[model samples]
Target: MLIGEVARRSGVSARMLRHYDSLGLVRPTGRTVGGYREYSAEDMRRILCVEGLRSLGLSLRQIGRALEDPACTPSALVGDLIRWAEDRLEREQELLERLRTVDASAPSGWQGVLRIVELMHGLNSPSAARRQQAVLAPAEDVRVPTELLAGAVLAESDPNVAGALRWALARAGSDAVASVVSGAYSENVDIRRRAVLAIAEMSGDEATAVLADALRDSDPTVRRHAALASGTRGVTAAVPTLVGMVVEGTNDVEAAEVLGRLSLDPECADRIMAALVDELAAHSADSAVRIRLTQALVEMSGTIAQGVLGQLAHDGDRAVALIASASLRPVRVVGLPDDESCDDAGRRHPSQVLRR
Candidate 1:
């Protein structure tokens, strides 16, 4: 077969075929009567071999060595090729993700594109401070991509940087809610905690729904954050968790205050009081737990807590009795009758009774 005929039949361009011949990767092994290049059957097979290797991302030099070196083993060379291709695939995937983020941002020009790219690089910087600055210093006219910010917030560990990232994510608005929620389901506990914290800062039905789901997370840390935020948002679903927090003494003070406010709702007040009273009864043997619960009662507004406190004033544990007795003093004079009245100011303990 002539060189032109081989190129035409094999779909290899003539220019590329000539270059392959020059590289010694394939030689015609014959000359026509007219001095034209004539490819023998074996030459065509060699050309096909080189093309096959090229399709696997092998460099021409590597391909040449692969074909020429009798000592070269296919297992070892193929292994190397696989590794190289995998590395390239990973890098390409990262580049493609960056490109998708940039396109999602909808930059107006190359300058906008460059700015966003720089911000993304900074967000991925090794130093926490640099990542924080990237979030803080975005161009006034350009919007930082929410997906990028959401991912950063989930992985950020530094207290200050995490706060800034959460703030930035909140500014990124509800579009970031789903990304942050996905982080809540991460296997890493720190990421799950960060996700809940970030979701706490976001507003909207979606964010609220995510928080509600987080309230039942297996990680106690995640559940506590969700409860605190959900309590503030008036999510009565957090009542049981908040009550448990009061019993456990972890963020118990804040939990009590939120529960107190939540208790103002007529429908929730009885249930809230019942939960507190039940915890108090359940943990009665632990004096410290009882003391904490007794103190938490000061934040409740309904008559149920007042009645509970009145009964606790004479609790079997002296410390519990003392704390409950002292907690009641500010409510009224020492002789004020129980189940009677100490006036409206004394009816329910002051809202600022406990600070956590």
Candidate 2:
């Protein structure tokens, strides 16, 4: 196949194919006398496997070994990468401490070494002014240092460092975007959650989709954080999926809160159907959750309010009624759409269903 055909089949750019060839990770089995590279089907499969391992964060050297040795476990490679990441984080901490120790104005015998360390730190620090210049500068001049900064910042102990790195990366655009996700799929939940939030904030479509996947995270708090971040991004594409999770998933009050928040939007109300309201109203669940759901409804009063409240009131469970009653107590603010929540705040506004 030609490079374009290979690029289309493998989703690896033509330029990247050339890069793989230079690295000897994937090379054409034969070359024309004029030196144009042609790929056989076997070569294309090899390139795809390389792409997959790369997606898993294997270094080309590391992936080469795994590909060459079928017994090698990719999981072991992941562990090695994680340790490598931790080592970098520790180095970042040490460097930050060393920088803090070196008083800029101090006179010292080790001034030269201190200055060198300071220079390395300076190279690490990216300023907003420098980043803006990269945006306007010609591509030849745009050495935005994206991978350097992203690697340095995988776990910066300071927001100042991370924020500066993020700005510098904005100069590099979507290419810089993948670094956030590279960290997200790691075994670390905290790492994944933070990466997911950072990516969602960057307004990247790939990041938005990946963050939604993180909502199924084992760490409820991470899932909650990821869910809220995705919802806040207004990626309504995730609304239907979130709606099902809210309606059926148990012990996921935070997910429910985010779902309720998203569905409160006029167009999303229908997705927050009676099943979801009942699930939220189910007193068996956490009270904190019921409160959040009621609060969400109060914030989005309309037909949703009337329908949810009326259902709660007519149900045999007076428990929901009590929650609704509490919601109505302040009727000053939207109350929990508990059963009796509306008895006091009742259909006074006339039951309104948000038109689809």
Candidate 3:
């Protein structure tokens, strides 16, 4: 077909055709005698492959091998990619586990969720963290509606159910898990806890206030989960609330876990340090709080995480002990890029970037 005809049929710009030509991706069979470009059926198939790879979350460079393999099946490709995901999740879980042991302030439910993420990290190929990374990177926009996520959660079952909801929520938002979170909040304490789990798994600031309201819930599990959810989404406002609970509130295991995630904030570094100082001044204080505080310091250091072991070389805490004992420790930081923010900046202009 002629370039103009191909452009019209493909809904791809002529300029993009030239760019693809330059990439030597969809090269012509031979030039016309008049020197105009001509595309064959084979070239069209290659273009279709490019489009398919783009939709499959593969970068053009990364898609080269797959595009070249005519026998490549999406199912097989996805399965291979799943193995890579499995390894990453396993490693991330181990790191999270080490962080948890040292972390005393974190809520039990928060730990439980992290553990779950640890167990099921490879359940989905594109995780919430990975999806957020893709969302924030230089690529075409892919929006999944919240309603779609909610419905999918109900239609699916365990193993796949949780991961699918998380994947959708990462691209969508809390509204995605609205049905599950809403349904759980009204049930028994355990049910409410599961709801909070759903919210945390697929969470952000969208339901921060709603989760915050749960902080005062009669159920400790609900309150604990709210604390953990706020931390995952970086709801700093809940810091003071969590601190109050840790200082004078219940000595619950769940509360402690939330405190651990809570105290992880670098912004609250000074506050946590001062808390430790205050405890040191009172010689009769409980070792339990002190243990959590040390875990908090090590965790905070890990979170800030650049040359942490070197900087904390002199800290006398056992949690800081990880710093002294190092053998190529791997540190992973996951989040959205600066440009592709989900809060409000992700909103698209009406029909912008639409193909005719």
Candidate 4:
């Protein structure tokens, strides 16, 4: 077949076919009297093979090596091709996400688009400081999209940068809640942890609801963060996890403070007190555990906690007795007369009692 006929039948442009011939990938063996290029049957098969390999993302050079080199193995070359394809796919995916974030920002013009792009580049920068500034210092007229902030919050590993991202997301409001919530359920534990922390800083029914759902996360870290945030939001379901934190000594101080605040509710007070008392009984064998529980009681309000403190004041463990006795003493307000105790300060709130 002449080059024209081959190009027509095979759909390979004549110019490309001539280029392929020059590269020796598919040189026709025949020629007409006019000296035009002609292709044999074998040459057509080679052309088809080259196109087939090209479809798999092979470079022209790699295709030549693949077809001409007897020692060339398909396994290694195919593996490299797979890896290159995956890399390309990942880059494309990142580009798509960046474009989506930009579109979501609803930029007013090219300047707005440029600003968003600049912010994205900063957020993805290797320097934590730049990422933080990207979140903290958005352009004057452009508000960083909530989705962009949420994405940064999920992927940020540096504590400072993550905190900044979370702060930005909080300022951006509940619009980012869905995006952050998806990270809360991520299969990656680190992502889930970051998600919960970021969502914890956010306020709104959506954020609170996501936090409540996160309370059941299999990862203890995720559950603890969700519990701390949820408890403060008046989600009584977090009481058990808050108590567990006290038992495990994980952020136990903050947990106890939250528990104290929760106990201010007349209905919840009894339950919170009961859970604490139960933990005290369960951990009686460990004086250290008992002492931590003893201190946690100070956060509780009303006479019930005082009674528990009274009993612990006389307990066998001297350390526990000391902590309990000290807690039982009336906490004098800094500015009030020595005679005026916290009780005389107009029934201080449980959280206030903890501060004292």
Pick by TM-score: which candidate is best?
4
Taken over the whole model, the C-alpha lDDT of each candidate is 0.86, 0.61, 0.55, 0.88
Which lDDT tens digits does candidate 1 get at residues 167-201? 98898855878767888888889998999999999
Model 1 TM-score on a 0 to 1 scale: 0.83
Per-residue lDDT of 4-105 in model 4, one digit per residue for the tens?
Answer: 899998889999999998898888998889999888888898999999889999988889989989887889888989999999999999999999988988
Residue 32 in model 4: shift from native, Å? Answer: 3.8
Question: Arrange candidates by lDDT, highest first: which order?
Answer: 4, 1, 2, 3
| Residues 1-356, model 2: lDDT tens digits | 88888899889999999998998889998876777889998998899899887886778898888888878887777788799889889999977755543443232446544443443455444563443333333333223344544554466545655565555555556766675678777787666655664665666677677877777777665565566668767656555445444444443455556555666576666655554565575745575455545444543446767667655555454655665555544333233343333346554344533210
**Can you give the lDDT of residue 324 in candidate 2?**
58
- The segments of candidate 2 whose C-alpha lies over 4 angstroms from its true place after superposition are 1-144, 157-172, 235-261, 264-268, 284-287, 310-356
Native-vs-model 1 lDDT? 0.86
Clashing pairs in 1: none
C-alpha RMSD by candidate, in order: 5.2, 20.3, 26.9, 3.9
lDDT of 4 at 254: 98
What TM-score does each of the candidates earn? Answer: 0.83, 0.43, 0.34, 0.86
lDDT by residue for model 3 (54-118), tens: 77566667577776778878788888677867887899987775454334223255554443343
